[model samples]
Target: MKAIVKGALAAGVLLIVGAGIVAGLRGSEPSAGPGGAPSSGPPRQRTLTIAAASDLKFALDELLKEFRAKHPGAQVQVTYGSSGNFLAQISNGAPFDLFLSADAAYPRKLAEQGLLSDDVFSYAVGRLVVWVPKGSPLPVEQRGMDALREPAAKRIAIANPQHAPYGRAAEAAMKSKGVYDAVKDKLVLGENIAQTAQFVQSGSADVGIIALSLALAPAMKDQGRYWEVPLDAYPRMEQGGAILKRAEDPELARQFRDFLLGAEGKALLERHGFFLPGE
Candidate 1:
């Protein structure tokens, strides 16, 4: 019996030693990095998801490219839509890390609902424009808002004023110019500003009231010509951004917010036709 017991103990010791050796070998192997490069340790990967307004589409795309260059290990995903819709989503506990609104009011509303991690800050002042695609029958530059009254202007697109800030501004501008009542019947509502631009670009609408930022985008710049809507015609389109309370990566969210308020971000916004808050 003693001989049998001794043999069993020796076998157990050998198995334990073998397991430890295998574990050590596995641990010594270098880990894979982002692009499958050998890493001395586990690489850090962080991701942030942002919900933004449609007007930010172009400028934000450029900003993200620069941001990712600076934060090589971080990934950012953006969803663009109407600010009011995003506000409703975040209020209901959407898993967004940040929210960039077309109007400060939406972010302020979120903050009031206690859904934001910090106070909202104005990032830019969005401008509205009257856009007509190339080869359109109406003389947009010559007639301006009056072009919508022409028979050739059968369909005019504007973001849904019920939710989109740009839409509200467009309505306000038309009303101020004494054209809203005249063009009301010709208006076709787009779900958002980007879609409003699409409506005109695709010839679904004869013209559109859209964000100047989108008009300045390379895709749209040559596709159409735009006339800036008089700034005084509507309430200021003060845009804002904030970090969400439920952000999985709060630090990253804050960094990105700061980046938007920084020099590079301001420059991009300006190039895309957005005005700084004070400007």
Candidate 2:
């Protein structure tokens, strides 16, 4: 009986030792990670991450959704901000796979700095508008810079020119109209086009100059009306896009870039009041 008990204990110890050896071999063989679990499969095919200017917020998203429908495996995530800021991020290694600027100049600068793919493209032309909220005494089209000049227009809103093309365009228009000097003191700046629209609609500012896309948004429809700023008043808002040179998934970036310039994408941009260069 004592020998039988000793034999059983020996068998149990051997079984435990064999299991440890099996586990160590499996771990050393790369079949398992250091955590002693099965190794993860191949790395995921990364999605394209685009950092676009704020004005392209909605239009770009609508196009992205369309692209995703056609290519279920590929994904696109958009981060929208000022063109200038987005440009800086590209320079500082922001991990943005692509950039779509509110103006072409930034993309051009990126290309000149060798931060962009060889094939940068002009995707769309952005338009600026002078907008006045509905039910307000101010008339948008009839008033123009004159409304901004009115004492009633004490709080006129425009985007910060340092950041937004629409703001620069509005500033140029103000200068062209010879109202910048008079209204500059009254100008309240928004960080971006979307916020500029909000300043007027919410009555935080008496009036605003914002992107046509925002003015055309359903929420803004009842809230405001806008007149397209004359193109000559400012340099063309030539929006451009490119895949970043440092992108880990450059082909995915290229696919998104092509998709944005394609027929469906162009139509989406047009539907939202963005004009093409050829248009």
Candidate 3:
């Protein structure tokens, strides 16, 4: 009985020591947050992939610089190409979070597929121009698409109408100006507005039907001049932007979309030759 009592006393002491040790460890454990937030893990971050039209290269390059400055840790990747080309890729299941088209047609088509909401938003109205390199034989002061009908214009540059919204706009403007039939054979199609501008800038083609924003860029402004196509001549180039339904970061994509529609964004777009919607 004496041995059993001593054994019980020893066990009781061991239990007390173990309990104290557990209490000490518990005291050392980090306190719970008021709402159970992690106290030590790194902050969560998100990345967004945006596909924009090539004409937005200059403007978006500048704007994105500001966007990152505003969002220090947000990851944003932009892919630029013809709006139509971007649509084709998106239709093929490209993993894009957002798309800012150079025209509204593509976004409307996407919305029809239920890949986007029916509520499409117009962001900008692109201007079209006839641009020639620094010293091409083309008269810098010539007005209208009629310039393309000039006998000296043996080879005129244009983007592929079937794939570029701006190209389609250019074609429509040319038809409205009654110059398409005469200048059709002389057409040298480019892949996009940038490429069309390149055809003229490189002396490969006499003049290019290009986005006015591209023509007004620093280099082009210094080397070339353009006459705006009368808005009445062609359908408005109502550009639209929307977030994809399957975006990895739909919320972030929407944030960027709102940013693009904000007043500051409109000012930037105007500075780049994009007119306000309905202007």
Per-candidate TM-scores read 0.85, 0.82, 0.82
- Tens digit per residue, CA lDDT, model 2, 164-243: 78788888988987888888888877766666766677777788888888777666766667777787887788888888
TM-score of 3: 0.82
Q: Which scores higher on lDDT, 1 or 3? A: 1
C-alpha lDDT of all candidate models, in order: 0.81, 0.72, 0.74
Model 3 misplaced regions, further than 4 Å:
1-43
TM-score of 2: 0.82
For all candidates, the clash counts are 0, 0, 0
lDDT of 1 by residue, 1-279 (tens): 000001112221111100000011112235577899887675455778888898888788778878877776676778888788888888888888998999999989888888888989999999999999888878878888888789998888898888999989998999998998887888888777887787778777789899999889877898788788889999999999889889988998999999999999999999999999998
Higher TM-score: candidate 2 or 3? 3
The residue-level lDDT of candidate 3 at 95 comes to: 89
Cα deviation at 229, candidate 1, in Å, is: 0.7
- Using TM-score as the yardstick, the better of models 1 and 2 is 1
> Which is the better candidate, 1 or 3, if ranked by TM-score?
1
